[model samples]
Target chain A: MELFHLVLRNLLARPVRSFLTLLGVVIATTSMVLFLSFGEGLRRSLAQELSRVGPAIQIVPEGMEGLGFSGYPEITPEEYRRAVAAGKDLGVKRITPTLFLVRGGFDPQTSFFFQGLPEGVAPDLLYPGIKPQAGRLLPSEEGAIVGAKVAKRSQLALGNPLRLSPRVELRVEGILEESGGLADNLIFVPLKPLQEVLGTENYTALLVALNPGQKAEEVARALEARLPGLKAQTTGDVMRFAERALRISDLVRFGISLVALVVGGLLVANTVMMSVYERTREFGVMRALGAKRGFIFRLVVLEALLLASFGGLLGLALGSAVSQAINLYTLGQVGLALSAVTFRLSLFALLVALGLGLSAGLLPAYHASRIPVVEALGRV
Target chain B: MMGAVRAENLGKRYRQGEKEVVALEGFTFAFPQGSTAVVGPSGSGKTTLLNLLAGFDLPTEGGVYLGEVALHRLSEDERAEVRLRHMGFVFQQWNLIPTLTAWENVAFPLFLAGLPPRARKERALDLLEKVGVLERAHHLPSRLSGGEQQRVALARALALDPPILFADEPTGNLDAESREQVASLLFHAGQERILVLVTHDLELAARAERILYLKGGRLVRQEVPGPSR
Candidate 1:
């Protein structure tokens, strides 16, 4: 314990150098935690959003498996009718066609996804747990329902007119309660009116709800088999596709974390090496005062451990703050929740910092232990 | 009775590039309990002989004994153990650890010896009082003057109350007045222990019970200033 105090005092003796080294560790550890936790948050958000949409299969034009809600080859009216018929034959209870369009937001450059459902389909039947918070659901071809986030962002209220284009406008019939998923950010209108606005005669995809005790995969396979030009995919297949699309993001996160760790380790090594060099003579004096090599080794390594532990704590705080700021900034438009700083992640960060400290301290501590008493004493 | 230190034909050699430079060779001596000074000129291997006697260095071809323990035959750790248990040392430049306060520096050996914190603190303060630096106990070595630092070093060397003490030019860096005061304290402190002084100060050398003169790594003469202690 006394030796530990001595080591601490040694670090305090060179305040500037120690502070700079600590700052380096803080920067590296903060970046590591931020990148990894953001990636984890994004992954969890994706899974939650997918799970909330329920275990329904989707029928889209052929080769549109992973293109989620955007830029898909539209299904012709005849194709849509045949796909709905095939779904009914495969034990599907409900088949609703939806047209997806991207329209400019209140701001010209920014855009949001607009989903169009059939005028008679109940919103609760399509989006479970979602209900009208105000007014009513879309009641006519010229009416619209704004999601919670869209209403909050665009300040659209019930009975207000929303302009889809220069010549197309719809009155806001209802506002949705927060659903805690992608539906929160969407704008919903009747299918025929959205098709007219998009200048298309076909739907983007069909949402098929399976009958009781009928498996989604079995029904999807049957629908695809019967409708030769359409593709049917279960919820699990969609999730896998989403995960594959995120592989590049995973690689980028891994790369950032790796770089942060290496930089942190190297910074620790450089700091410890410089400290050892500066204290060569003092170490010799300890040797002459009867300190063994093991004693010297422990003293130096203890300094590094303290530095890493403190730096890691600072990094965790900084990283968590940065994550909260990101969450506030993105506001879920990117479908990312950046507030996933779990206890497990905090523990992992501490362990990594400790391991790096020990690894980086090894060479310098060994060199300090091996310093020759006479030669070191001779140094000025 | 066994002498405090015994050396049998102790020799030390160094390799300066390709040549083997002999620092000390064919040296033999037995030092009893009291103050003895080894006076020599530069390059006369005074520090080398002191290092060999204190178990800080191994003799190239011979051995030294601290009482019954053969110093040269032991491993480095064992030799350090011996130094910690039975010997104390003061160097030429008052080499106190710069990061430590005066009291903390004095307590270091006690810390290495695994003494409890309260006991280490008590002993260190007592030693500082003995050396007349108790008031400056909280000052770091950098804050203290050369003389004060040496006093702290002296107090630290005496912390364990070892049976043998070695001083290698302890007053070499002090002013004349401080040197007189330090030399007096050193001689008085040696009354109960085996204090060996390596120096070229004639006046300090004359105060010892015996003085050995050396040149070319050889002891040329031994003079008894007065009756042996």
Candidate 2:
């Protein structure tokens, strides 16, 4: 502990060098934190969105996974009939076929996610416990219900006119309560009118709901076998696929961070090596005054660690602040916080910084300890 | 042999590039307790001899015995331990740690000896007061003038109260008044211990009870001052 105190004093003596070294570590750590937070946030959002879904399985075009908006709706009316037939004896509660469409970006006024269910199918079939914060769910073919975030962002209220195109017009009959889930970002429209807007009569996907004791896995397997042209994914299956994709993204992010981390290591090494070089004589003086080689070695190593620890802490703070700022923008645009700095990530980054310190400090510490006492004292 | 240093035919050789340069050769003497000075001109091996005697460098030939320990046979770590526990050093440049305050610098050796913080501070403060730099106890070495830094270095060297104190041109960089003050402190502190000083200043050498005069790398004359002050 006493030796450590001396190390702190030694670093304090050269504040400029220490601060510059610290900035290197901070930049690396902050970049890493910001990069990985996206994975953390996506994982959290996906989990919440899945939990809010009332159906146990989603059958979409082979490439379209879950409710994600992608590719044109290609499930023919015949395939939809086969999906319903596959679940006939499987104790299926409801197999609601819906159409999904999305358009626009950057401009909230022009952007929209439109979920089209058969007229009078009730939004509760897809989103359980979804309460109308104002008015009521779409009660007829000429009205729509807006998700809470969409209503707030686009400044829509019940009785406001919504024009999907010049030919398809509707009134906002309801505004959803914020569910803190995917339901908070969708706009529910009647299926027939949406088909008219798209000029296509094909459905998007089938959301399969099973009875309390029914097995979703067995039903999904049966549907895939009967309707082989389409893919049936259980809630777990969708999550796993999403998670796998996320892991790949995570590896890419970590790979990018490695470069910054290496630079950080070099910065720390350069600062510490320079310190060791400058203090060679001082070390010799200490050696002559009864300090052991280990003493000098430990002093150098401790200085590096102290520098890294301070930088790592500040980096975590900076990363977290920047993450919230990113989240603020995303929450406004997508109604989802797309970056989260988690506790585990914080711990991991700090440990990595310390590891960097140890690695960077070792060679210099060895050199410092090996200098003969006489040479050091003689160095003036 | 307590509080005594025995040099057994001490010699040191260095390879300067391709040529072997002999810095010291065949000089053997048992320095008894109390003060002694080694006086020589430039390139006369005073510093090399001091280095070997203090175990800062190993002798190429022969050995140095501080009390009963064969310093030449000890490993580097063991020699360092010996220095920490039983040796003190003062140099021309003072060599006080620039980062530490005057009293902290003095307390450092005590700290290496595993002294507790409170005890280290107390002992350091007492020594600083004795050296007349108590008021500058908390001032860093850079903050102090050259004379003050040297005084603090003196206090540090005396911190362990070891039997052996090595001084190499302790007053070489000081003004006359500072030199006198440092020399006075050196002699006063060396009265009961074995003090070995290397210097070119004949006046400082004459102050020691005994002086060895060196020419080149060999001692040609040993003189005893008529009376010790």
Candidate 3:
């Protein structure tokens, strides 16, 4: 108890030095938390977006994978029928074929990737839980369903005519609620009207929903084997590709976080070492008062641990506030807000702070414990 | 029980670069209850003898005993325990921790001994009152004068009610009036404990029951104050 009192007094004795050290830890911890949280949020948002595309296998034209944004290459009607037949033979539950038509929006300079689905085949099966927020579902071939962002940006109201081109005019039947991803940015139209506008009798991709007990990968493989010119990709395979695309940014964020932690550890070590140097005579006095070497060691370590814990908590609040601000700023532009901080992530950050404190204090505490009593006394 | 310290054929050596320096050698003495003074010049190893007696340092060639226990033969932790239970020290610099208030400094030893907080505080206040510094108990060492700091240090040394006490130049940094008051307190405090003081002041040395003179790290003679001076 006396030792603890002395430790507190010592820390309070040099308030400026202690505060500076704490500030260093706070900055480093804040950076680490922010970068790591951003990385986690980005990864989770991508995963959620991929998952929302449904538990179906996307069968695209084989060479379309390398095409950047020219839109999915059209597969012939004959080939689409053959793929659907093969999927049905493999116990598929449903198959939704979608045509991609890239056309200018109301503003001729801005283009929208318009998707066309058959009138009876529900787009809800491809994007589950997506319902019209302001109007009924598509009721006619000329009717269109627009995503929330598209509607907001275009200011299109229900029953309003949206002209994609001179020959393709459709009435806005519904506006979707925010689906939290790219789905909130698309415009859906009836397949036959879009096909008529594009003068095509084919779709760009087929979404195959397998039976409950069927494996997606196995069905994908079977479709690829039976349909020679089509590429069948399970959702997991798509997610893996997305993850690979995100790897560089994740690695960079991780490296920055690692540097921040190292800097925090170094700051702790330097502060402790300086404190030990300043209190040599005081420690000797404690030694003469019958304090063991271990007592001195524990005192130093306890001081560092206290500083780290306080700094970590403050950093967490600061980092979370900054992340929330970023989330608010990006939600409107990107249609996906940053992920919220979890309790587990907070606990992990605190644990990292504690581990850094212990590691940084080890050498300083050992040095404090090893000071020769007589020599330390002679300092005064 | 009152404890006694005895040093037998004690010697201490220091290595300065390649040269070996013998600081103290061939010292032999036994101290029972009451006061004794060790007088020597700056390089005469007076502090070395005190350190060995207090078990703060081990002798290079001999051993010290506290009652029936061989102090030098024990490990560092055991020596620390002995110091806590049986010995108290006052150094030339009034080595109170600068961060602690005088009261906390006085209560340090009791805290080390695992005494309850109420008991430690009461005992510390009592000792501070005895040393005439109870009113300064809340002041830090920096706030206290040199004499008051030394008095608080004295109270701290006696905190655990140790059987033996050692003071090294306790009045070296004080004015004449503070010195006289501190010296009076020291002599009165030594009435029931074995007190060994290391100092260069002959007048202070003469007040002790026995005075040992050292030269060239060796004890030259022992004397008792007398009219013959």
Leading candidate by DockQ: 2
Alpha-carbon deviation at B104 in model 2, angstroms: 0.5
**What is the DockQ (computed on Cα atoms) for candidate 3?**
0.55
The sequence of per-residue lDDT tens digits that candidate 3 reaches over residues B57-172 is 88898889887899989777778888888888887799988888898888889988999999989999999999999999988899999999999989999998888989999999
* Chain B TM-score of candidate number 2: 0.97
| Candidate 3 structure quality by residue, lDDT tens digits, A1-380 | 46667777788898998888788778877887777776667667867777787646888878665212356447788988887788767988888788777776554225576778877755576788888898865547888888888888778889899776678789988888987766687788888877787678878788788888899898899989999988888778776776676677656876878788888889889989999998888888787778888888999998888778778888888888888888887787656666456676688788888888888888999999888877778821
TM-score of chain A of each: 0.85, 0.92, 0.82
Which runs in model 1 stand beyond 4 Å of their true positions? Answer: A56-67, A73-95, A105-109, A155-171, A194-248, A257-265, A332-336, B1-3, B227-229
What TM-score would candidate 1 get against the native?
0.87
Separate DockQ for every predicted complex: 0.48, 0.58, 0.55
Give residue B198's error in model 1 in angstroms: 1.2
Q: In candidate 3, how many Å is residue B187 off?
A: 2.1
Write model 1 residue lDDT over B1-229, tens digit each, in one string.
2357988998889899999888888889898889989999988888889888877778897899877879899887788788887888888889898888999999999999989999999999999998888999999898998888888988999888888889989999999877877887788889888999999887788899889988998888899996533
Query: Interface RMSD (Å), each candidate?
Result: 2.4, 2.2, 2.4
State the C-alpha lDDT per candidate.
0.83, 0.88, 0.82
Order of candidates by TM-score, top first? 2, 3, 1
Could you give candidate 2's per-residue lDDT for residues A292-344 as a string of tens digits? 88889999998888888888999999999999999999987777888999899
Inter-residue clash pairs, candidate 2: A290-B84
**Candidate 1 structure quality by residue, lDDT tens digits, A191-310:** 877777778888888888888999888888888899888888877887788777667776787587878878888888899999999898888888888899999999889888888888
